[model samples]
Target: MAKRISQDQIAKELGVSQSLVSLVLNGRREGVAEESYKMIWAAALKQGYVPRGGMHPMHAPDVQHSYVGVVMRAGLALAAQSNTFSHVSHGLFTALQHLNISLAFLGGEGDLDETKLFEVVSRRDPLLGIVILGEVKEPFMQALGELELKLVSVYASSPGLCHSIVPNDKQSVEQLVDHLVALGHTRFAWLGGNAKLGRNRLRLAALKERLAARDLLLDDRYVVNAEGAERQDGFDCAAELMRRAEGQNMPTAWVCHNGLIARGGLQFAYLRGIKVPGEISIAAVDRTRACTEIHPYLTSAASDPELIGAEAAKLLRSQPEEIGQWNKMFIDLVAPSLFEAGETSATRPE
Candidate 1:
C-alpha cells in the first residue's frame, strides 16, 4: 500500500496551521473562514490524504475517484425498483461519466438522518457539488444551502437555495385533459393528489385550471386527496369514492396523479366488477413502467426523468459563480408527452 498523507503535510503545503487543517477535516466550519475551509480541502485532495481506514474520496477501490455526491430519498435497493428514480439515476450517471466526474453516493433516508448527512458532506470528502434526487425537508435543505458546495435538485426546487430541474406540469395537464376531452368525456374526477409533495400540489392546481379552461368543473365530492402517493392510497381513495357514489351518478372519467395510483384505480375496478373505458375511463398524469405491468396498459402523460437528471447534472457541472447569479433561480422545465393509445381510456359511454 502507498504511504498515507498527513494533515501536517497538507497544512504545510497550504501555509495553514495543522490545528486549523484538523478542524476543517473534522467537518468544523463554525468560526473558520470559508477561504481556509476551501483551501484545506483542496490541498488534502491534491496530496491524496485519505482518512485512516476510510476509502479515499477520489480514489476509492474498484471505481474511479469521485467528487460529486448523490443524495436520494431512499436506498439504492428501493430506488432501483422505481422507474422514475432509476431513469433519473441513469441520466445522471451517464452525464457525469461524460464529464469525467465520478459520483459518490451518500446514504439514503434509512441510512442517515439530516444531521449525519450534513456532517458527511462537510467532512467526509472534498465534494465540490451535490445532486439531490427528490424532495427533502425545508430545514434540511436550508442546512445544505449553508455548505460551500454547488447544489442541484431533480424533481423539486427551492428558490434562492439551489437550481432545480422538473417536468412541465402545465403542458402535462394540458395533454391529459385534452386527450380525455377529445374522447367525449364531460364529467371528471381527480385521484391521488398527495398534498405533501409540491409537484403533486402543482399538478392538482394545474388540473383544476385546465378543466376550468374547457368550461368543465371537477366536482368537490370527486376530488380525493391521497394520504400517500402509493398504489394502496390510490385503491383506498377509489373505494371511498365508489362507496359514496352508490345510488348516485359516478363521473365518467378519472384522472390519477401517477401510474401506480392509476393501477390502484384499475385494481378497485377489478374488485368492484366495473368495466374500464366502457363504464368509466381512467388516466394518469405521470407515466411510469407500472403503466404496463397489468392487463390493460394505462394511458398517461410522460415526464422525461432522464432529461431532468441530465439537466440537473449539467447545472452542477457549471461553475458555482455562473449558477448563483442575479438572484434568479434556474427552474428548468422538460415538456411531457402523452401515452394516449392505451386501453384504459376511450370515448364517453352513450
Candidate 2:
C-alpha cells in the first residue's frame, strides 16, 4: 500500500502553516479566507481524509463519500406529519436534510427510555450522528454521553451529553409582552398549568420578569401554574380564570402558554359568549401551525421549528471533530419569527 499522507505532509505540500491547514480541514474557517478553506476541503476530499476519526471503530463512514444514520427519538417525529406536533423536532429533521445526512425514525419504548433509544442508533454503523428529537430524560441523555455516539438534542439540553438546538424564549416572551402591551391591553391573564419542568418554568419566570419590567404582574389568580400545559390543563385554567374574573372581574386579555392551551382558552371564551379581541383579546406562545386551524387564529410569539431542526443537526454533526475539545457550541436560541397580525389582535376589549 502507498504511504498515507500525514498532517505535516499535507501542511508542507500546501505551503501553509499547520494551524491554518488544521482549521480548514476541520471546517472552522471563521477568520480564514473562503478560498483557503475550499482548497483544504478539496484536497482532503481527494485524499479521502476526514478531520474526524478515519480509522477508529467509532469512526463513521466517510461523510465525504457516503454517510448513513438514523434519527432516533422518544416519540415519532410527528412534526414531519402535522404541524400539530412540536415544531422543534421538525427543525432538527430539516437540518439533517441540508447536511445530506440520511435520516430515519426509530421510535423508542415511549417513556423516553435511554436504552431503547440508544439501540435505535446502535445499529447502522458509519452513521454520522443520531438526532434524538424530543422528550428525552436526563438519565438517557447521560447514557448517550457514554456511547461516544455523536448526538444532538432538539427539545432538551444537557452539557455532558450532546449538542442542543432550542428556541430563544427570552426574546419570544419579551416580544410577546411588547405586542400585547401595544394593543393597549394592560390587564392580562396567563392560563397554563405549572410544573417543575425546567424549560416550562423558565418560560413562566421569563414572562413574569418581562411583565414586571413593564410594571405588570402575572396576577397569581389569572395564572394557573398548577397543572402542566396539557389540553385539560388549558381548558381548566381558562375556565378557572373566567370563573373568578381574577384580576378585574372582567379581564381585558388572556395570554396562554401554548397553542393547545390557546385552544382551550378559545373554546372557553367562545362557549361563554366572549368574543376574542372584542371582549378579551388573547395571545400566547404558539409555534405549531395548529393555531391557524381555529376559527379565530391565535396570535403567537412563535419560534421557527424548521430552523431549530437544522441547527440541532448541524451541532450534532460537529460533535465528532469536537470530541477531544472541551468547548461546546450551544445553540439554544433558534431565532423565532413572531406573528402579531394573525387573526387575533384588536384594541383592548371594552
Candidate 3:
C-alpha cells in the first residue's frame, strides 16, 4: 500500500505546470515529447495510482479505493492463454490495485451481452465507468450507454464517445523499417498484410509508403496474406511464402505482421533449415507473445499489453465533455527496442 503521490510531484519533477502534468498523466497531453510523457507514465505505473473519476485535475485525494469495468476484445483472451499472458495480466492488475481499482472483466463470449454486462457493472459498489480494452462492438458500446458509463476506448476511439490510447502506427512502423533498412535490408517479406481492422493495417500501409520512399518497394512476390486466426494458418502461410521465396529469389529480410506470425515464420524457416539472418532475417511489427518465451527471442516492435489495459482504464474514467476533446488520443511508444537479435538478423551476403 504505497502512499499516493500527487500530480504535483510529477509536475515539479518534470519542471512543468501542474496542469500539464495532470494532462499528460491522464493520457490527454498533446504536443509534448513522447519520451517525457513516458517518464510520467512510468511513475504512475510504478506507484499504482489511477486518478479517480470526476476528480479535479490538480487535486490529490485520500480515498483508499474505487473500481472500473473492463471489456476486452475477444482475441486478447485467446492470446492471453499464452505463457506471457500471466506476466502481462500481473503487471496490469498490480497497477490497478495500487490505484485502488478492482477490475471486473466483462464482454467476452462467456458474457458478451451489453445489457447484461452493464447490469453487472452497475451492481459493483462504487463503480464509475467502463473501459473497452480492445475493439468495441455495438453491444458493448450500447451497454455503456445504458449504464450511462463514462466509457473509455483503450486502443481505438469513436470520436465523441471516448478517449483512446494506441501506439503511434505510422511512426512506429516507419521507425522499425528505418532500423531494418539501416541494417542493409532492402528486399522484405511480410506475413500479415491486407487486414483492414485495427492498427496492423495502418502499420502495414505505412511500411509500404516508407519503404517506397527509400526506393524499396515490396514486389507482389514478397507479400503473404494470412487471413485466419490460428497459429497453424500462420505456419502454413509462412511455409507457403517460403516456397514462393525459393521460386522468385533471395529476399534480404522478412517482417511479419505481428510476433505470432513472426514465431510461425521463425519455425517455418527453422524447419526448412534456413538459418535466419544467415539466410533470411525475421522480424515483426507488434510485440506480444512474439519474441519472448522461446529460443532466440524475437526482434519486434515493443508492445506493453498492460499499457492496453491501462489506457482502457483511463478512457473509462474520462467524462463526455472530456471525450469530445479527444481526437485520436494516442501513446507513441516506438523507440526501436530490439530484444535479442537472436541470430534472426545479420548482414546481407554479398
Candidate 4:
C-alpha cells in the first residue's frame, strides 16, 4: 500500500509547524489564527492525511461519538424538495460529509411536532448540532431553544433563535430591476405571490425601491398577485395581466417571482402569440434548472442554494462560544445573488 500522509507533511505543505498542524487536526483550535487554521485544514484535506483514528483532522477526532441533526419544518420540506432546495441540501450534505460528520434526519414527518422532535433528538446521543431548514412557529422555536444545541437555520430568520443563512432576495430584486432598466424597458409588472411570505414581500419592496431609484413607477394596474410561487400561479397571473392589458397599454416587461412563474408566463405569452423580447421582455429572481428548461433561457438573478447550504453547515460546526455571542443578536447572514442574462430580456420595443 502507498505510504499514508502525515501531519508533518501537511504542516510542511502549509508552511506551518507540525505542532500547529497537530493542534488543528486534533480540533484544539484555541489560540490558532483563523487563517492558519484554515490553511492547515486545507492542506490536510488536500494531502489526504488520515489521523490515527481513521478520521480526517477536520472531523472531531471522536469518530462515532457525535452526529449532526437536520430538522425540516413541514412547510419547509415542500420547498426543500424543489430543484433549488435540492441543490441547497446537496451542498449541506457534501460539506458535512467532508468533515466526517454523520447527519440524522430527526423528524421524518414534515410536521414540526415538538414532542417528536425532542424524542428523536434525545435518542441521538450527544448530538453535535442542529440545522433547521425552514421557518418554525414561536412554539416550535421555543422547543428548539430548550434543546440548547448549536443551531443554524436556513432560509428562515427568527431573532435570538438561531444563526440564520438566507438568500439576498432584496439584492436579487434590485439586480433584476437594474438589468431590465438597462435593457431600456420602462414599464414593468411584478408577478408575485402571497405577501405574507417574507421573501415575496422583500422582493416586492426591493423592486419598488429599485424602480423608484430610476424614476420609474410601478403602477397598481401592472401588479399581479398569484396564489403562490408555483408554475400554475405564474400562468394564472400572466393570464390576468393579459386581461388587464386588454385595452390599456401593456407593460414593456414582466418580473416574475421565480423560474416556475417565469415558465408559466413564457408559456402564456407564447400561446397568446406575444413575441418574447420582441413585443415584451421577461425576467425573474431565481436561476434554478427550470430557467434553462424553458424555450428561451430566462433572464434572472440567481441565488446559489448550495453556497447558502454549505455556509449554514459551516456555521453549525463553529465553536459554541462563537455562536453564543450571536444569540439574541438579530443577525442577517445574506448571500449575494448572481445575475444571468438570457434571451427573454432585451431592449424595450420601439
Q: RMSD, each candidate, Å?
A: 7.2, 13.2, 16.1, 14.1
Cα lDDT of model 4 by residue, 143-219, tens digit: 88777677788878877778888888888888889988888988899998644567787788888989999999998
Better of 1 and 2 by TM-score: 1
> Order of all candidates by lDDT, from best down to worst?
4, 1, 2, 3
Overall local distance difference test of candidate 1: 0.76
Write candidate 3's Cα lDDT for 93-208 as tens digits. Answer: 66677777776665553457754764565342567666665566665565555665566565566555555555555665666677678888888876773254565566667879
Q: How many residue pairs clash in each candidate?
A: 1, 8, 2, 1
Candidate 1: 10-residue stretch with minimal lDDT: 74-83
User: Relative to the true structure, how large is the alpha-carbon lDDT of every model?
Assistant: 0.76, 0.65, 0.63, 0.78
Model with the higher lDDT, candidate 1 or 2: 1
Candidate 4 structure, TM-score to reference: 0.77
**Candidate 1 residues 1-350, lDDT tens each?**
88989889898888888999999999999999999998898788667687786556566655554468777754344445445776777788888886567677775645666666656665654675788877877776776777657788777777778777777777777788899999998888889645577777788888889999999998888888786767888898898788767778888888888877888888999888999978889988766677777669887876777767777777877764775552355545454554555889999998
RMSD of 1: 7.2
Rank candidates, TM-score, best first: 4, 1, 2, 3
Compared with the true structure, what per-residue lDDT tens digits does model 2 show for residues 92-152?
5566655555555545425445656545444434566666655566666666666666666
lDDT of 3: 0.63
lDDT of 4: 0.78
RMSD over all Cα atoms, model 3: 16.1
